[model samples]
Target chain A: MLDVEGLAKATGAGGKEKIKIQRQITLPWVEAVRISVRNVTIRLGRTMITASGIVLGIAFLSSVWTSGVIQDGLQQARFEQERELVAATTRDQAKPDGGKTEDSAAVPGEEKQAQNSKRIWLVVMSLLVCGVGITNAMLMSVTERFREIGTMKCLGALDSFIVRLFLIEAIALGVLGSVLGTLLGHLAMLGIFALRERSLSVAAKMDWGQMLTYLLLCILIGTVLSLVSAIAPAVRAARMRPAVALQTEI
Target chain B: MAKIECPECGEQIETTGIVTVCPKCGADLREVMEAVGHERDERMKTIVRDDSVTTHEFIVRTRDLKKIYVMGEIEVPALRDVDLDVRRGEYLSIMGPSGSGKSTLFNMIGGLDKPTAGRCFIEEVDMAQLDAFELAWLRCRKIGYIFQTFNLIPVMTAMENITLPMIFAGMSTDEMMDRGRELLDMVGLGDRLDHKPYELSGGQQQRVAVARALANSPAIVLADEPTGNLDLHTGKEIIDLLKELNQASGVTVISATHDLKMIDVSDRVVHIRDGEIERIEHRADIDLEVGGMGEE
Candidate 1:
């Protein structure tokens, strides 16, 4: 009922009479999603360029996780070998000649702990680099779309809409980049295992549930990092006055 | 059905045709119409003003509106005590040189900026009192803006650009497309609906901008230098198109421009200088043959 005709009637009354009409238009979630997706598609090159950092970060994370699984498998194999050696020594001692038992002990736990700490350091470094890349990319995107943002504001887009728009775009990039990184990490782990053990069966011996959880965690981190980076830019864009925004040259 | 309120007497009266007298006060409402230079038509039916009531007769009213921008330690004054009234179904132009605050005033009336020292009322609703959401609703339903740069989203097609506002207004996809197509046809871009901004000529893009501005059927269409970027011929075409739409739809238009041709189509032209209103020229009082006088 709050159409053009109604607006005309209300204004034509010279602002004296109050027309009790509901005029708020709630933007649908589907439309928001559609717009965000279309926006990402239109600027595919830029989006990819921005997402590359996230991809690398997640890939590094995946590598670390995969390495942890391989280390665990290697440890189990070493433990089994040590157990067999100990069993052989016991059998020798049970012999009638009573042969002198030689010590057959597993590798020290300190070495394994050192290797794990190094992997953790690498993962942490990769995450820091990824955060910086995402932040830079989001800031650039906000700057580039200054005019578009102004136009939307002029067309009555709410501040919340602007915020959601950026967030959705970031989320889309996060999901894609995380998936790519996870795949790359899996491939990297396979290569490492192949080189170390000369067999692909090491991957098979790893816990599948834990691997999946690690990938999921990487994806979650990518998304959260993207969202965090986008917040400042989104808020800055929403706070702009349409008059000043319109004056922007580009 | 036609509805008209009596100016002399505060009474809401419903009539099938133009009513000459107020049934309650016997005051000649026709004489009041003549006093305000309003023609007896469907467009003028609701423009009843009472001198005693002091309610605004204009759709947009400003009282001592001022805007001062503070940058760092310096205070820059953009608008200084601008009092303006835009009547229903009227085309008004604000003319000034660059940096004379015409655009500032336009922004204030369009609900795009807030005044520092005064009040702006759109349809008698105080704009300064509205929250961000309410202001957005006002801008969405009450105002449409046509920019000098033709501010179309480069990635979106003409049809998409036109329907953007409707989408914000929560219109369904079918409804948006229907209205968008109609507007495209109205603006003579029916075949160019699928063209992006880069594919279209400047004039064509401006026409699309015009169509998009009318998508929501806003009460007031504020155009800031609509012809500023077009060539002379294209500018004239755009002006003619705007004039046609104005006459055909009876929608109120407020434009800020330096173009003499644009001012020629206005019912009244307000001359502004140094953030203040210098003079107002009515259509009849304007001398079109004088060529250019105050244009920079």
Candidate 2:
């Protein structure tokens, strides 16, 4: 009731004088929102560079999975060939035995070894490609933010805030790069499959579990590596004195 | 009020309320006013504390400090052992040459950098003992700073830059906007609140920086070469605004600058050289009229 009376008086006075006193403490937040948005904006392009590594990892992972599918098809084809040969020989020799030797050769050990080697090569190569690229990208990002990191420390920003900022940037990069790389890798796999068999949609047989695992692993690796790489620089920056940073010519 | 001869005409002039520069020739003010000596007795009357004291008194104090930088095996000492005290509502300036450690001293006082060895008391609490979060809280709650180059975030508008610290302080959006606008008006930049730093002149940019510094009503305003980037005329304008902030709001002002203009208004000047205090001079004790008149 007091507030309403004050409001009425304020209206008569023709200004903002009649609002509740609590309104003085509460202000419009648009400026804060705008500032936060700007901070995110200034960092977006640089953050994209950090994410590039994630994209590479995703692309390699998708291609390797697609290749594994092709290898499966090859195994099936070899089985079919062995079955046909066995049938022809058995038919010609007039000996159709009930023993179930359908298609495999007398020695299965060598065949199994060869298949294992191929799968091992694919998985090893994929891990190597992802790890090396992600590490390199992280190193570059840490170096680029050297001065800015120093400035923030001098301004009284805590080490935790520095760590959180870099990690968030890395995550954003990872998500964007992974999604785009997945789409591109899927499309490329389809093209390759069509080249071999016009009616085959081999790329459409995406193993969601496998893809999700690969993406999660790659992002986790990237984020961890980035945080690790940022540790040294962040410390250096946090311990930096404002006087020294301002005096720095760079 | 002390009396001193004018450096230009050798005419005796009253030291009290006398402009440092000669009325007739406008000679170098520091020299003209040197004869009066630092009137330490007069400093007692200028105290301007108000009702805003909260949680503490005497936000920052420094004693016998030094900072030495070791670069590739060379030990370069910056700040000398210096003792100073900044209470609420006082505006002080630190002036010296390029190699002089004014900037370093200011940085340590503001808790932006730690001194190599010495005691610094901020808000009656030992600065060296504060943890990282505690230091951050102190900076957020009790201190505001302006830099010479107008370190406004490039991508943000005048309003956003002013409100940047408030965001870190976890102020609500409404509060930040209201505070930001109030600051802009205080600095006479309300009309340019939406403009980016690039669009503003050097003076305007400095004004924006001042508004940003006051966003949280920090007890101390530490400015390092705040007017160093502006032209002479613009520099004078900035000085005027800083004076206003000191007089009107009672915000303690500490500036590190080579600009001689600061000597006129600063309450005290501590000369540092080779990482040591060569001399500590008060403004009132200078013999202002002892030089240049006879030579002329």
Candidate 3:
């Protein structure tokens, strides 16, 4: 019922009516919103620092993938150019261009081999980064909320409830990270495609289905990683006797 | 059906099909029609319309309640057959050393944890009989809890934290805001409604927490070491605010604390040690100056 300005006025006046006037001052919703915004900004800053490692890891993995794709395209183009020159030479030399011809088949095979190797290396690096990123993020989140997690369970929040909360947070982080990584990855890929004179078609665009599937997979991985990370910690937290939890120093 | 509860009053209703009215206090009811439609004698259908007074008025009661846990091979009894009664408008303190079951007792009383055995009755309603939903509803409306660490949602502002109970209860936006402001005023945090927990000092944060706890105007407030994080001066101020709220609004308060200064102001102090009630003493008798207590 009391307004904040009225409260300020009363405080400034410093009279016997200060108590009555202080009681009459009410904080406006705008002020509540402003405070919430400031708090959210701070929370976001903490979250961002924690999530930065994951984001950087994802960005690196995605860039490696993009480069691998570019390498594959370039190698294929070179292989095609080499095959065309070889075909011209064979024709001029009166040699038959047979599928069984060693020279003709060998060029394509070598190109395919190069592409396969590049893809394999990219996949392995990406997986490693993802695994590390997930593990790190989950560990940090669990450690940060160790007391809170314990308090929640002591307050009768079930294991499932705690798991859901962690998973929800993981999913939120995954979605945001995935989107940012994908966007930046797309732009990087687009730069290559432009250099090759390839028109930007919707097909060449980032496969959103792939993006969504990967995001969901990231969410699942992040959740599983969080649950795995939190399992020992959550149990530790849950088993913390209420007496001990209450006595815990922050 | 497990008839663990009363159909009319939500008590563990005893006695079946003999209801002329509530037997505890006879009040008129639209008489339940018998399945057989058997004609009753005129004397059997007596309805005393004047006896509307409720008989069971104790807000909380525990009778020989016990909670035992096994840690590996040893049996750890957190609470051992503790009997307690908390009446409306009475401020009581549960005081103890480190291993006392004060926190456990508060948790069970608020229905945040289940008792291992025996009965806990709140508002004459036995907690052992209610389902999860019923228990949640009871906690929603009947009890408010303040933890030692100022358990305001760290992500939220003071106002949002204060309104959390009503938010859980599905109150309308305007109604929740109004009630939140009222609570903020009651706890004397009207000016800092927009501040976050980190923005406020320890005492101010505790005040915000107190406002949040009283958001729904629950009949009982259970605080566990609310001053553990505060300085002596701030702690005293916080205790004074709690006392003022209890005095002004007739809300029953049960605080578990080691601060003897807090005990100095409480109406009664229930001392516990080794998971057992040592004694229940009125504040008028004990000087509370015998021990020098340190802040947690």
List model 3 lDDT by residue over B1-296, tens digit each. Answer: 01123336645432223344555444432243232112221211221011212322345678789988778999899999998877566779999987788878887887766788987876656677665445555555556778888876677788877765565455677998877776665555677788878898888788887876766566678888888889987788778767756765667788989998887678779999888899988655675553321210
> Which candidate wins on TM-score?
1
Q: Best candidate, DockQ-wise?
A: 1
Kindly indicate the candidate among 2 and 3 with the higher TM-score.
2
Q: Candidate 2 recovers what fraction of true contacts? A: 0.18
What is each predicted model's overall lDDT from 0 to 1? 0.78, 0.63, 0.62
TM-score of each: 0.81, 0.72, 0.67
lDDT by residue (tens digit), candidate 3, A68-187 = 555555555666677788778778989776764566568677878887787778767766776677567767666666566544433334444445555455555555555565556545
Stretch of 10 with least lDDT, candidate 2 chain B = B40-49
Which ranking of candidates, highest TM-score first? 1, 2, 3
Runs with alpha carbons beyond 4 Å of true place in candidate 3: A1-42, A87-102, A114-118, A121-125, A149-165, A182-250, B1-55, B69-74, B283-296
Quality of model 1 by C-alpha lDDT = 0.78
TM-score of 2: 0.72
What stretches of model 2 exceed 4 Å from their correct place? A1-43, A73-122, A154-156, A196-200, A204-250, B1-60, B194-201, B280-296
lDDT tens readout by residue for model 1, B186-246: 5667788899999999989999998888888877788999999999878887886676566
TM-score for candidate 3, please give it: 0.67
Model 1, residue pairs in steric clash: none
* Candidate 3 chain A, run of 10 with poorest lDDT: A16-25
Q: Per-prediction DockQ scores?
A: 0.25, 0.09, 0.05
In candidate 3, which residue pairs get closer than 3 Å at backbone N, Cα or C atoms, i.e. clash? A2-A24, A2-A25, A2-A26, A3-A25, A3-A26
